[model samples]
Target chain A: MRKKRMINKFTLYISLVILTFIFLFPLVWMLVSSLKNEFQIFRDMQSLQAFLPPAPADVEGGYFHNYVAAFQRVDLLRYIVNSLIYTIGIIIFGLIVNSMAGYALARFRFPLAGFWLGVIIATLIIPPESIFLPLYVLVYDLGWVNTYTGLIVPFIANAFAIFLFRQFFLDFPKELEEAAKIDGCSQIGIFFRIIVPLSKPVFATVAIVLFINHWNDFLWPLVVASDESMRTIQIGLQYFMNEPPIKWGQVMAALTVATIPMLLIFAFLQRYYVQGLTHTGSKN
Target chain B: MKGNDSSAEKLENERHFHQTAKKPQLKPTPPPRKKRKLKSQAFREAMTGYFFLAPALVLLGVFLLYPMGAAFYYSFTDFYILTPDDVSFIGLENFKYIVEDAQFRQAFWNTVYFSVIVVPVQLSVALGLALLINKKLRFRVFFRTAFFSPVVMSLVVVSILWTFMYNPNEGLINQLLQTVGIPPQPFLTSPDQAMNSIIVMSVWQGAGFQMMIFLAGLQNIPNHLYEAADIDGASSWQKFWHITLPGLRNIALFIFITISIAAFKLLVQPMIMTQGGPLGTTKSLVYHIYETGFNYRDVGYASAMAVVFTVIVLVITIIQRVLIKEERG
Candidate 1:
């Protein structure tokens, strides 16, 4: 029995290690390929050498040139700045607005609160694509085309965020607010000082989710930002490969740089990501 | 004389009793005012809710809802970029064209086929991985992050990376296959393999999310059921097949439907990797809508297609919900 158990454990470990490799392979390959020279990357597709391959004497200087060319061609710095401005703008506004709405739905005993919650949750089912056409017309009519407002306005209040916040606030101990009221604190005062401060995990979760969505959003930005000057990194990178003579090296370099910020952000805030997801999953 | 004084005191007491009766009247007045104040307070709370929701509502209405309505109206019109004044009602014609158009039909079928093949494969792999990591394994967090990292990377980045990875000449995939003496296969290059290649990349990127969902589901299952199974000498397979499978049913259904819907909207990979080509084999309905609206500037026809696509998605969602709800019932 002991020997049999040992074999089962060994099999489980072996299978797990193999599966881990399979899952991690592409990301690993991409990272290594990002460091290798064009020729080396193309030469040994299977070999581990393809990633960070040893360079011949002549190829020593090409790597920096690739990155520089990538930055120059697309104005990557501007794209990053554009992404940051848009993402940060949405997150700050989205968090405050969503939390306020959520708090009301959870705490207040207003007529039609349940109805309003239902309506908002129903919107979650209507895929955003279904509404894209009307939104474009509205933006055009308002002369918001090619503007920051056009990109940011429609997404400022997310249903998921509101729903998540409301759920979180529902379980929030009433004693905290009651104590504040006894101390002669107003509702708004207690909210700002007490409620918001206590909800750090959910706040972090919302920030990560909102920032990632806005940062990676390609379709909306594609429609809104027609000018090269306003183009986001996602859409900006596409211009490189859209031309007849595609520059693979430069495209890879640009993609590498664009993806780094997201990876770093997600890596740091992953615990929050899982936390928010758990809240949603469990509620449902 | 004393009896006369007692009578005077009684008369004074009667007068005081009359004033005491008036005190009850004041209580009724305060009740109405208190009710009015509560009503006003409720109204104020409602207004605050609206204020909080206003920003999101305006944008959602303008960009999302307006576009949806326009797509419906424009679908029936003969809209052209060149002559805005020449627009005319062409009811059912656009729909007729979609039904008759070979490429449109092919794209529609391809999307359906892709969804059918990809959703299950992706979700199953995700569940498998989730189960694996749900065990108390070493480096579980590292493994989880590694699996999900690709999901954070943009489609443009993943496509570019995978395009190289799928390169028939020097791609890692082909090199691995060559080691097993299997001839190098054209992945994205071949029309036959292009969609499959896209699916592989998509599944790799997407499975991590479903895996996370499955992990949550797995944790929710009661360990006592497995413990009971062990007492009965039930094999691991039996426990998984009976308890684990039944426990994960709702999550599996949810993931399946979500993945199906997401896969149906396949646009980015084909656009970036193949440009819907190696012969129009990779063009999806959403991409077609984009091409028509942007490339050709045939807003009217594109709107028609968009409306059709939206209806199809809605129908699918409803069907999925109904089916799953029935099963649960």
Candidate 2:
């Protein structure tokens, strides 16, 4: 029995290690291959050396050349700044708008409250893809195409974020609100003072999700932001891919640069991100 | 003395009559005033609620609901972006064209095929990974993180990276296959292989997200059920079949529906990697709509397709909701 159990444990570990390798290899390859010269990448394709960085080359600037080349070819810094502006704009505005709406639905007694909540929830069923055409037309009519307003404003009021905030506020203790009310705090004041502070977890969760979402948004920005200077990182990468004679090293470097921030954010907030997503999945 | 008494009695009687008349009128009047105050307070509260909700409601109306309505309307009209003034109603013409368009038909089937193939494959792999990590293990968090890392990466980046990996000659996948003595396959180049390649990459990139949900589901299953099964001398497979599967049913269903919906909206992969390629084998509906609406400048036609697509999604979701509700009942 003891020997059998030991074998089972050994098998489990082996399988896990293999699974881990399978999952991590592509990312690892992308990162490491970014550090190789074009020739080295092609040369090391067949062996374990593909995972290793290049040795010092005499002619090229060696490992960092691809990074420099990628930066030169695309205004990567501009794209990064665009992504940040859109992401931060969405997060800040989304939290305020969605949370306020959520608070009203959760706390206040009002006619048609149920009806309004239902309408908001119903919008969740409408996939954004189906309406992309008209949405683009609307933004164009507003003359918002290729502007920050086009990129950020439409997405700031997410129904999912509102639903999350509403769910959180429903579980919030009413006594705190009662105390604030007795002290002459207005409805909005209580929300700003008491509810928002106590709901930091939900705020973080919503912000992280929204930040990742806006940062990674491709389709909407692809339609709305046609100008080269206004492109986000994802769109920038897509444009990079379209260029002919695709330099594999620089492409890999650009991809690595684009992906690093997300990985770092995920590393730090893995728990909250996982929890938030799972919470959403289960609620649905 | 007799005249004085008569006058005093008459004065007292008149005063009493005036007091009785005033009391009934005052009772009814005060209640109305109090009721008005209460009504106004309620109205004020409702106004505050509306004020708080205005920003989200207006945005949703403009961006989501109004666009949906506009898309429906645009489907009936020839609303080209370039010529804004020449718009005219053309009832059902775009839908008729969509039906007759071979590419649209191909895209519809391609989308269905991709969704049908990818959802189950992704879910099963996620469930398997969830079960694997659910066991007591060393460095479990590390393993979970490793599996889930791809979910954080942008779809565009994933598509680009996979495009490189799908390179027939020097790609890591083919290279690895060659190490095991399998002949190299043209993954993205071949018509037969391109869609499958995208599906494979998609599953790899997407499974981690569902796995985390499954992992959460797995953790929520009480351990005592397994303990009871062990006391009954149940085999490992039996334990999983009896306890784990049933415990995860709702989550599994949720993941299934969501993955199916997401799979149906496939665009970025084909857009970036295949560009609907080799012979339009991987061209999804959304990709087709994008091509029609933007590339071909056929907004009405694309709007028609979008309406049809939205109806299909709505029907599928309603069916799922009904099924879930029935199961719960």
Candidate 3:
């Protein structure tokens, strides 16, 4: 029995190792192939060499010419900047607007409060894709197409963000806010001074969530912001990939650049992301 | 008189008044002329509440509510984007037209086929993974990280990467298959295999997320239950079936609904990789809707498809909610 258990454990380990390889080799290949020129990449493709960096002596530009080529070939840097602008704009505006609305629903007894909360929660069931057509039409009618305003402003007030913030703020200690009020802090002052500071984790959670969301956003930008200046990295990469003479090296390099920040975030902030994953459905 | 009320009385009132919710903070009143000041302050707070909600309400109104309303309203009429003024109130025609539309039906069936295959397989992989890693094992952390690394990639990147990998001629997948003595397969080139290829990549990308959730759920199952099962001479499979599966019932329901809803919106993969090609076998509902609305400028038909898609989502979600509500009892 003990000998059988040993065999089982060994098999288990081997199987898991193979699975890990299957799961991760694409990423490994993406990074490795980025370092190799097209000729060396295809030449090394069949064997385990595909997952290794090319020797420094073989390549003319050494390792990272693809990174330079990615930028020079297409407007990749501009797309990255545009992505950051739109994503950050949404997060900043999203956190304030959604959180304040959430706080009101959670902590204040305004007229029609229940009605408003109901409306917001109802919207949560409706994914943005379901309504993108009319939204594009609306944006077009507003003459805001291809503008940052069109990209940022429409996505600022996310229903799910509002719902999450409301849930978080409800659990906040009412006594602390009550004491702040007794000390002559106005309602807004209490929110800014006390509630805001105390709610940092929830704020960070929502911000990260929003960042992951808008950064990966593809369809909306494809429809509304087709202009080269307004293109997000996803759209730019899509166009870049499609514009004939596809270079796998530069493509991998560009994807690596696009994906590295998220990997770094997962390394550091996996706890919060996992928590969000469990509590909420995987939005992606 | 109010000042004379005990602190317990105040707590009691706060608790009782808001039975299912938390009460808003009511400011402490001074000894004299408290009621009028309290009333005025209450009004001021309510007004401030409205002020706080103003920006979100405006955006949600113009962008979310108005667009949804327009989409619903336009679904009934022959609302072409090019000839916007020529729209007429043609009741149920768009819906009727879809009944006769073969391409729409194909897209719908393709979406269903994706969800049907991807959901169960991904969920099983996730659960199986969670079971493996939940135990104390060497290199488990590395294993978890490896599995989840793909979730960090955007769908666009993954699609492009897989398109490269799925290339039948010189791609690595076929090369690996050949060494195992298997014949090379046309993955993305064939219509029948294209959706399945996309499905495989999707499961690889998505199973990691569900695995994390399942790991969480596995940890939540009390240790004593398994210990009791062991003491009762139950086999590992028996313990898993009786304790583990039942323990994860609610989470499974949740996962089922989320996966199915997301699967129904399958547009990105077909868009990037196959362009919904090889005789439109890979054409998803959203892809078709997008093409019809934007490419062909057929707004009314796309709107009808969107409405149908939204209703399917809402129905699935509502079913989950009802099931969860039943589970709570």
Error of 3 at A28 (Å): 0.5
Residue A51 accuracy (lDDT) in model 1: 47
What local lDDT score does residue B183 receive in model 2, on the 0 to 100 scale?
Answer: 93
Clashing pairs in 1: A131-B64, A133-B67, A134-B66, A134-B67, A134-B68, A135-B62, A135-B63, A135-B67
Encode model 2's per-residue lDDT on A15-48: one tens digit a residue: 9999998888889889988888778888788888
Please write out the lDDT profile of model 1 over residues B157-254, one tens digit for every residue.
Answer: 78877886788877788898887899999998899999999998899888988888889999999999999999999998999999999998877888
Q: What proportion of the real contacts between chains A and B does each prediction keep? A: 0.47, 0.73, 0.67
Clashes of each: 8, 0, 0
Model 3, range A121-201, lDDT digits (tens) per residue? 898888788899999988989999999999999999988888888888899989998898889889899999999999987
List the candidates ranked by TM-score, beginning with the highest. 2, 3, 1
* Residue-level lDDT tens digits of model 3 in B53-84: 88899999999999999999989988888887
C-alpha positional error of residue B104 in candidate 1 after TM-score superposition, expressed in Å: 1.9
For model 2, the superposed segments whose C-alpha errors exceed 4 Å read A55-63, B1-29, B32-34
lDDT: worst 10-residue window of model 2 chain A: A54-63
Off by over 4 Å in 3: A281-284, B1-35
- TM-score (all chains, Cα) for each model: 0.89, 0.94, 0.92
Looking at model 2 chain B, report the run of 10 residues with the lowest lDDT sum: B23-32
Pick the lDDT winner.
2
TM-score of 2: 0.94
